[model samples]
Target: MGATRSHRIPRRAAHPALAAAIAAAALALTTACDPVGGLNSAAVAVTTDQVATAALQHQHVDIKWLTCTAHLDNGPRATPSAGSATKDVADVTCDGETKDGRPITVRGTVTQEVEGRCVKGDLTAKVADRTVFRASVLGDCTAPAPTTTRVTPAPGGHPTVTVTVTVTQSFQGK
Candidate 1:
């Protein structure tokens, strides 16, 4: 009998170099499709005022204070030489009104994680240690009454108040 002959095609593995090239090409294509600057984009730095505004908004409760007053233990410190500087810790009290002009008073503590204008995790806000403080848009945090003795003391090496205006809208500044 004649010798039987069998023919079969051998399978070959993909080249490592070819696989790597394909992967690199795919990555490049994905990155090129990005319109806005991705990782390479530079973020604009915000001011301390901006961050403070955000922290205030974090309270979630609105206090119409545009005409009221505020005292911060470590809020915004005014310097006789230059401008004011934001503090790291603060005990703040804002006496103002609500949107409807009801009187309201809000107190809280704000802390700046870092000494910068950034306020992501660096900014923290906590309401005053109280159950519920009366707030309104038609009146001040407290009803107007006669004063016994006037007292105004500095926060003791803390920022006092830079803005007396109550903030309703979010901080929309750069």
Candidate 2:
């Protein structure tokens, strides 16, 4: 009788280093390939409109605008230290009753700046006189730097090419 031999299958060991690199690459690729969501653009623009309309209809309109900023002195490897920011918000609450107790209020917000540079978009509103209310302002100032990729020239006499890209939003808001 002939002897039969069984073949064994070989399994490859998982490399954590390779896995991490792949994950990072995937994250970068997804970010770079993704487009800015329209919903967010709508949100930024909508905030302005909400304030504008509220000011016009409400008796007392309180207008608030906040400005925030984030600075990074280090690359991805190190944590960044945040600096104190100046207030860019303006609060204007229109009370229908003034010193004489008349009725009228105008609430609104204007585009602001961070450390002196204009940041958030424009906003404005007005309400009937004699109305009373409070206002609030809020903002964030974290701007993400664009990611770049360098390409090497094939074998020909080609120069290196650098591409500017952003995978995900550096900042977000409600």
Candidate 3:
């Protein structure tokens, strides 16, 4: 009997270089499609300067104030009243996006009072005329009121003893 003959096609091994090229292309495509990669593009909108306002309020107190005056602690000496306070603070700013792709900036400040003796060494501490405090997207502008202590020698007539106290800080978002 004649010898039986068998025939089969040989399979070629995958090319290492081809595999590397394909992997690199896939990586490049993935990185290019990332959403954050085009952050500088025109499609990314930004907000502009915006203004906002807020009010400051007091909640509690420990010492008796002369009156609620703008001075840190100035009031009528004859009557015991809560003193008014003007806090040194800056405005706040924020960036936001609207549903329709509009950019917005929000800025605001709060009016509040501080507690303490109004007269100290004849130098009364009033709220600075300039804005010294500021708030940002990640910052706040609330500052405790600054106070000074008044020292008066114990005298035979009406004598005043002054103690330093911080005023309450309050805020209203606007």
The whole-model lDDT of each prediction reads 0.28, 0.27, 0.21
Which digits, one per residue and each the tens of the lDDT, describe model 2 over residues 37-98? 21111122223232333343344323222111111112133223544333223322222222
Tell me the TM-score of each prediction against the true structure. Answer: 0.24, 0.20, 0.17
Ranking by lDDT: 1, 2, 3
lDDT of 2 at 157: 32
Clashes of each: 18, 17, 10
Give the runs in model 2 whose Cα sits over 4 Å from its true position. 1-46, 52-82, 90-105, 108-126, 137-174
The true-structure Cα RMSD of candidate 2 reads 24.4
Candidate RMSDs in order: 29.8, 24.4, 34.4
**Global fold similarity of model 3 (TM-score):** 0.17
Error of 2 at 49 (Å): 2.5
Of 2 and 3, the candidate ranking higher by lDDT: 2
Model 1 lDDT at residue 8: 12
Off by over 4 Å in 3: 1-85, 113-174
What is the alpha-carbon lDDT for the whole of candidate 2? 0.27
Off by over 4 Å in 1: 1-64, 67-88, 113-174
Candidate with top TM-score is 1
